[model samples]
Target: MSIKGLAAKIFAKRIRKRIDTWANNPIKTQQKVFKDLLHTARDTAFGKDHCFKDIKNHKDFVKQVPIRDYEQLRPYVDRVVDGEPDILWPGKPLYFAKTSGTTSGVKYIPLTKASMPTHIKAARNAILCYIAESGKTAFVDGKMIFLQGSPELIEKNGVHVGRLSGIVAHYVPKYLQKNRMPSFETNSIDDWEKKVDAIVEETVDEDMTIISGIPPWVQMYFEKLQHKTGKQIGKLFKNFELFIYGGVNFEPYRVTFEKLIGRKVAGIELYPASEGFFAFQDKQNEKGMLLQLDSGMFYEFVKADTFFDEHPKRLTISDVEVGVNYVMLISSNAGLWAYNIGDTVQFTNTDPYRVVVSGRIKHFISAFGEHVIGKEVEQALKEGAEATGAMIKEFTVAPQINPEASELPYHEWFIEFQEEPLHIENLALQIDNSLRKQNSYYDDLIVGHILRTLKITTVPANGFNEYMKSVGKLGGQNKLPRLSNDRKIADVLTAMTTT
Candidate 1:
């Protein structure tokens, strides 16, 4: 074997050894994380303000610090951005990751020098974990095409502001730079359509074995490749063997991706956002990603139902229960103190502590007594696709409740299909049946006639993409809401069928 191949095997084995060690005793590993975080930032202003030196245990630490969201912490971040030293963490942050999340138009999240390890190191380990679990590393010798946003950054108050993936791209290792495709010129283009075209032109003949990105963007890249070369992606890239995706659940798009690739390839899921890298698929047999305890970030969970209450119950790793939804909170090295990142997760495993992201805390369909989540919608769509032999490209669900009417509300599903099903009504029926089987509350509501059965709206092939593009949210980790609590987005989509 080649020297490089031998080194790759050695690296994978080492990462697997570490994974096994940490997974053996999760609670102890978590406690060590908390203690280390306390000592690391004890001299910072935030630590001094919260009395971190005197707060010895979890209970005291919780009592000393209050939970906050991005808006609540904005003033302090603004001060740090304007050349203030040691306002939150030690000195200033490395850069700010800019995003347009639900509650705000543009939010700037800090990335400290201490927190940089969480972004890059955890990302590296996620790939290594997949390799260790799947036992496939031949792809390492070939190129990887990461369908990401522009790496160019804009200076905001003397600090760089751009997408987190873009920032990471700018700092890629020198050796791997040779095997990464889409030259700096193509990657630096700001337009998504033009940039994708440039990427296809640049990597059409390269030895690509891995392609990683959010699914929708990667699907678009695949379509572009087919259009240019008049060949299936499998034919065009014979060495392709691995797929990495995240930012949204992959279950709904699983069949579409398989069909596009013309075969099944090993896939890995990541749980990452601008706040922190939370988890990644660690074992091939398990569905949930192992909760990362020894990472630089410390985690806490507040029951989602009581997240907004005056006295919400905050639970540590020891208290978190399986199957219960909890809003995630963290005190990371990124100067965040019990900050609520707005995501809600449900624990699926407790021994080693694994979790699956259920949905956003503010984004849910609880307008009626029945509370449906993202997992239910994605799973139902997968079942619907199977029953009807359709390929759903994109979808969003919203409640159609009319205040003027005396009747109950019903759900409206807007779907974009790659291959149109023979019976659209049957597809809708299958999806409704699948959702009822999964959610007891929803089933009870349907049985009681409180809410009518769901209604499907067949949209143009690229309808969802067009809507996202119209709103200027076409790419890079921005997902169209699958389930909205109200009819505002539903109404907009209904009107788009006419346009």
Candidate 2:
């Protein structure tokens, strides 16, 4: 091993021990975080508004602060944007991570000095955990590329504002400066395809060992590189050993990615959002990411089934159970209190509090009370692809509430396949059966003759890419929704379909 690799191994050992201490005592670690966040923000405007001083425990907190999404919290966020001090956190924010919102247009999530380091540290620790567990540090000595948004920032109320990935680019550690690929100039290119082309040109011959990004964007980068070099990614970068991804499930893309790279490489899944760095896959053999209890965020969980009720019970870490779907809430040092980030997660392992993201609370199909979720669709597609040796590029599902004349309505699946299955009809049946097994409500609807088995609509090659590009969200942390109740996305896909 090189000097850097040896140093990384030693450093990783220390990080592993530190992580273990908190992971082993999750409840205590979270309680400490809860107390710290309350104490630190007690003097802020939000704290005063919410009667934070009188709040002593989790139950008191739930009573004091109601869960609010971005639109509901925009009043305080607007004040902060207008240069108000201590409106959310203490004083001014270090940065405002700008992200596109569904109904609220653009949202600026605050990043305080106290909360910013948690994001950086959590990302670093994820890699360290992998290094320590796998006893593999050689990747630390080679080139690493994180395909992300531009690093350019604009001033907003004296605070730097940009996409979270772009904002993070400013904090790349001094050690990795030499090994991180894709020059800042190249990264700054606004057009994604052009930026990716520039990245391909720069790193096609580099010793790339780690590539990190959302799966779809990274897939685009891989496709571009393959087109340019006429070689599989594994052959082009023989040293590439790891892929780090977040924002979307990676299972459905696994077969397609393996085919593109011509080999299987280790992967690390991260559960990060604009709100906070929540979790990361720690062990190669584990099924879920380790929840970060000691971070500057206190977490709460409400059963997803009851999340829409007038008063849903919020449970703390000690109260959560394995295998239950829960909507996650947070009260963090960044000034977000009882904030619903819209993610639904299931506890896979309670010993260390490991969780797998189940779906988005808002992104699901309950048009006919079937209530199918993102995880079910992704898993079903993954199983179908595996059974038929099909390589799938991307897919989405929407309810077909209205159909032509005498036919029963069914779920419509829009799929872009990298390699077509020999039996297309069999693939659809298998996927439908898999979904039926996972979601009993959907199965009951099928049995009651309220709905028919799902039908597949094959999308032309690069169809999903074109759709994203047309919507002006072709890259930079944008994820295609796996399930939608409305026909907004489905209508667009249908029009693009020739058949």
Candidate 3:
């Protein structure tokens, strides 16, 4: 057998063994095992630190550890850059994963050598689960294409500066590496134009079997591919089998992708962040399954309903109820304890821990399944406004579903700009078109020219900044609220519209 095939077999066996253990264990036993793993991780990262020493005796070690967001961890990142061991963990961190944060700022999340295995194992389990679900042995032997960022590691003074994607690519098995497409390692953050060009050039003549990445980037790649090849992507790469995606929701972009590819590519959802690969889509054509890295981190779930109300109930993995939404809390080997990542998800099943992402607990508009979150809407606005040569000073989106039968509800875009409005209607159309192109659901909903129209209202040049200052949130860390669930913001937009 080929080395890749052999490796796959071994990986699959290990995954099956783990799954069997999870399936056979009693609930009490499973809980104990999970707790033990968390304890071990805690000891490994902060055993000697004064802050963690008392954790053993503390009633709420998880709670006392302090729930941290990306901004809270930036200082530790500075420490890593200085070549000092991270305060969060006992030893030196292995790499930093760079990702865009809520404020449109860059965040470098630390990952340690001890924590890396959890990511690798979880990713493998995700693949194995796909195999098991398909019930197919000897599936097509073809190269899998991971549409990842540039593989080049940032460096200082000739030493390797590891990024998460770089570390994964660096440590990947030699056999797999041999068959993989050449990564765009010439730059740190990919030069979008050049990277797209390279991807098109490389794959134009090759038989790409699997494709994976964020939906927007993937769509961009295929669009570029079509432009170069003079044929649709589905026709060029006939051998393609799997379409794995993560870092963003695929539902809005699904119809466009399927239509472009001309077939329903087996989709897998991956839950990976800078810190780690937390979970992935387990079964073929199924929603994501939270593969508990019992050997690496401790997991907790806060019931969604209780989160916003007074007195929230925190549930362990064993306590999770199927079909209920929960905000995930994780204590990982990288030394984050009881960290609330802000993403909310629901348990689809519990036997193997399958889940579907409901939405972000914070920073979102969910009047419908649009699932339009702050980051996404922000990007859409940026792209749309920039395309029209209009620089946006600030903007907010709120669902304005009219209560009256004769009235129509649409997204009221309260926009502030430095430039005079050239054409408000044209700008609004451009924003709507950008959103529709990016999100298929938005396209479908807008097709009949019914439900949720985009209404643009120009505000004073410094309106958003003024609003931010008013809220005591004016700074590098603060961002304009893109999506608001409450009607208060909508009321303000209405007031702005009238005035």
Candidate 4:
């Protein structure tokens, strides 16, 4: 092995041992993080307002700090943005992770010096863990591309502001800098389409081994490569071994990706957000990402079903059980206290605290009380595709309460197919059956004559991409919702079908 590969193997072993220490002592590690976060921020304005001085335990914390989303915490965040010191964390944050919000317009998430390094470390550890478990360090010498936002940052109130991915781009380790692809000039392009084209031109002939991004954008990159070279991605880049993705489930995209690549490759799922780098896939054979119990963040879980209740019970890692969906609340060194990050997760393994990002708390179809979630829909589509040999490019689900022919109301699924099934009706039926099995309420609705089985609305090739483009969210950390309660997206997709 080369010097780089040999070094990676040694480093990977150390990281694996460290991971084991924390993973085995989940509760103790979390308690330490919880104590450290409170103690560090005890003198901040928010700490004083919430009586952090008197808080001694999780019970005291629950009494002192109420759960707050970004909107609810904006009063404090606004002051921080206006250059207020000690408003949330100790002093001002080093940077603000700017992200788009549906109701709140723009959100500036604080990234303190203490918190920023955790993000970098967690991401680095994820790769090291992979190397240790897989025993594959040869890729360390090859070129890798991270499809992400521009690294350019705008300064505001003495704090740099940009997308989280862009901010992370600045922290690439010096050793790997030589192997990272896409020149800085190409990555800084404002337009995603143009940026992607530039990236293709820069790295198409390089020794690319690893690709990382959200699924949609990575799919776009793969498609661009195929269009340019007229070769399957696996053939075009024989060493493209590992796909690292976050922000969405990869199950529904599996068949399409396999078809596009012409072979199966290993993948690593990451559960990261503006709030924190929460979890990462550690083992090659494991089902879920290992939760970061010692990453300077304390976690609380509220049953997602009862999250909005007047007194939803908040449970820690010790109280969590497998297979139950929970809305994760976090108190981190970055100055967020009891903050609801809006994503729901389910523990797949509780012994070492591993979890899968199930769905967003808001991204579901509950128009008729059936309350279908993103996980169910993705799994259903996966099941249907497997049974009927269908390859889907993308899909979304929304309720259709009214029908043009005065038929019974049903859920409308807009699907973009890479390869159509022999019978579209069979695919729909299979998916509906799978969903019915997963959600009892949906089954009851269908049997009680209140609603019919789901109906498929086939979207043309590249239709979803066009929809995202129309909204100016075609790429770069943007993701299409897998489920919506309303017809906003469905209506636009319906119009495309007619035109």
Candidate 5:
């Protein structure tokens, strides 16, 4: 190995040691560290000189610190953008990570110097944990490709600034940054399409090993790469090892990716948003573990069912139960307190705090009294695909409301099959049966024949891509909506469904 490679290995070893020490330490000690961090964050958000003095008493601290959300912090975020010192923190923030928010078109989440360590440490620990679980020391040291949004940071003078990815690019070990692929630094998200096209054109012949990004965007990149090269990406990139994905589920797209890549790529779940890196896939790769940044913010979980209800059960990190679905509520250093971000997840095990993302709270289907989650839909689809000897490249489940009667609601399955299955009808029946078996409410509703019908819409070879592109989302991270409960979904199905 070269001198640089040896040094890289040594550095990785030291980082790994730090992570192991942190992970093995007692939970109580960790919790105390986390609590102290949260208090510090609170002081920074509220005026430090004034707030810091009053926060010495625990009861007084909790009472004085008001719950906050993005809307509440918009003014502070604006101030950060204006380069005002000592607003949220002592110094100017490094840069803002732009994230998609519900009301705000794009929310620029501030990351102060004090808080950047949490993000970096969480990300590093995630990787180290994965290495520890796998018992693999050497990952193929090749180019690491992060399939991300345009790194361009918006400037104060109305001119766009540096790409946040590029800013992160600088922080990465200098050697790795030097060897990393060039980032797309366009001003508009719309321009990303052409930029991605350009990347595909230039990198067709290059060897890429580690790939990271949202699965939908990665899938889109691979599809384009295949189209341009006229050969599967597996043949083009010989040394590809790890596949890191975040922002969505990877189970749905696994088969397609495995086939295209010709290797079983390790899936690393990253829990990063514009806010900061919250958690990441554990070393075991079985589930994602929350990198408890107790210091960064206090964490809370609300039962998924409580979202629409007036009084919902909210659990602190100490109160979380294994296997129960909950929506994450974060009180972060960036000024979000008791905030609901909408994504739903469940803990598989709590000893080490491993969890799997279940679905989005808003994405659940409630038709004929049967509440079906995205995971259940995915499970049914997987079973159906297995039984019918069919490969489902992409799919969606939408409810169809009867025009004559507002009370009547049925389901329509939109599928993109890899090959024409011999018995498509049988496949649809199997999917419906699986759904009925998995969810008792669905079974009861179907038995009553209230939501009786299951209509299948088989699309052309590359129909899913066309659909995603039409919606202005063409990539690995953007999934075809698996469960659409919205009433307009029925109209969309009516127009699109052929049989």
Candidate 6:
């Protein structure tokens, strides 16, 4: 057997035992994580400030360390950036990941020596668990292309700082390093268009067996390859068997992926962000991703509806219910104390907890008092795309609330398509129906005639791409916000596309 296949067999055995052990009693695993942190950093400033030394359980931990977002925790992070040791964790962090988000221009999230394992080990186990469940290890012996950013990092104070993907890419296994592409030189190209051209040139004829990246960027790479090779991706790399994606939900882009790959490949979903690698698709039969219970982080959830309340009730793993949208909070080894990451999620399965990312808490629209979230808009778009044989390249939704423009406020969806629908009106109907089914408030608004039916604006192809380029965010890691509560992004896009 090949070295990777042999390694996969051994790793799979370890992961299988862990899966059942952690699943059977998640509360025990969660409690263990909480206790471990309290024990290790009881002497640190944040530890003493939060009374970690006296905290006996999760309830006490919650009472002492109030929930906060990144902005609220900026003072503590500033200390870390200024070279303070034992601020959030014991000693200093190993690095900081520079994240570009919608609300914030830049967010520098710490990555401690302790928290680094949470990223690496979970990624390894995600693959090992897949191998255990599927028994498909042949691809392990072949090459896998992880499309990521440049590994070169900048020194900030005493710590290295760079994009999360770039930092992680530097740690590719030696065995896989032989096959990973494009080269560091190619990846370092700052311009997205130039970087993409380089990636296509490097991997067009390679024996690629697996590909991992954010879906939109990967789709761009595949299309470029097809155009250059004068053949489909399947023809260029017949051995390609796995499609690993995260950052953006894969549902809306599913049909586009099929067209690019030109064949079926196993899809593995991961919920990874600058803060932590939170979950992974554990079973092919399972509906949602399995949460990482013992990954050096304690998890909490505040119901999304009440997330903006004066005093929101935070629920631990033991209390979170299935089917409720929540804004997640984490107390991790990176020195963050009960920090809210802004993204929202819903528990699809409670036992052996599994979750689906609902949407960004700040990225929702309630212009007409019908709070429409990211997940609802994407689901509506997905259903619409599938029903009308439309393939979406990119999309965004914004609230149109101008009093002069109409009698009532409604949603305006700006979509760029890979394949245009036979009739866009049919696509609109499918989207409206899906939204009404998912959110009753939205349905009631339609019924009460408080808002008119939704309007779909189909932009010319590459319209969204040009906008991203103009903003210097045209790349794989960056994505267009699918929903916005305000018209900031929508107005800019509408103006650009109309011109």
**What TM-score goes with each of the models?**
0.96, 0.99, 0.70, 0.99, 0.84, 0.97
Off by over 4 Å in 3: 1-11, 23-59, 73-82, 135-140, 155-163, 184-189, 308-311, 366-499
lDDT per residue (tens digit) for residues 295-317 in model 4? 88999999999998998999999
lDDT of 5 by residue, 1-499 (tens): 6665555456567766765564455366346654564555554544563364555543444455443466776787677677666566555666676655445766666666666677666665666655555654345357777765555455753323443444454466565664456443421344556766766765676678777777766776888898787777777887776788777767767777877787676767877665556677766445555555443655667788775676565666567888788888775565555566666888876666767777877787886668898888888877877777777677778777663556556777888776546888888898899999988998888888787747687766667666667656665234566777865544544455453
TM-score pick, better of 1 and 4: 4
Preferred candidate (lDDT higher): 4 or 6: 4
Give the least accurate 10-residue stretch of model 1, judged by summed lDDT: 1-10
Candidate 3 lDDT over 1-499, as tens digits, reads 5555555666676787776676455365445644554455454423344345445532456545555566665565566556666456666667776655655376666677778787777766767777666644343366666666556777642234554655676666565565466454532334555665776777788878777776655776787787777776778888777787776666546545766787766777888766667677766645556656464566778886577665466677778887777888776777666667777777887776777666677766657556465545655666665667665545678777764577666777787664534787877887777777766776777775566568877776445545555554433213345578656765755554566
- State which candidate, 1 or 6, has the greater TM-score: 6
Q: lDDT per prediction?
A: 0.85, 0.92, 0.64, 0.93, 0.66, 0.86
Evaluate model 3: give its lDDT.
Answer: 0.64
Model 6 spans with C-alpha error above 4 angstroms: 403-407
Candidate 1 structure quality by residue, lDDT tens digits, 413-436: 988888878999999899999999
Cα error, residue 365 of model 2, in Å, equals 0.4
| Root-mean-square deviation of every model | 1.7, 0.9, 9.7, 0.9, 3.9, 1.4
| Residue-level lDDT for 360 in candidate 6 | 90
TM-score quality measure for candidate 4: 0.99
Candidate 3, residue 432: Cα displacement in angstroms equals 16
Pairs clashing within candidate 4: none
Task: Show where candidate 1 strays beyond 4 Å.
Answer: 403-408
Worst 10 residues of 4 by lDDT: 198-207
Residues 24-74 of candidate 2: C-alpha lDDT, one tens digit per residue: 988889989998888888889999998888989888988899999999999
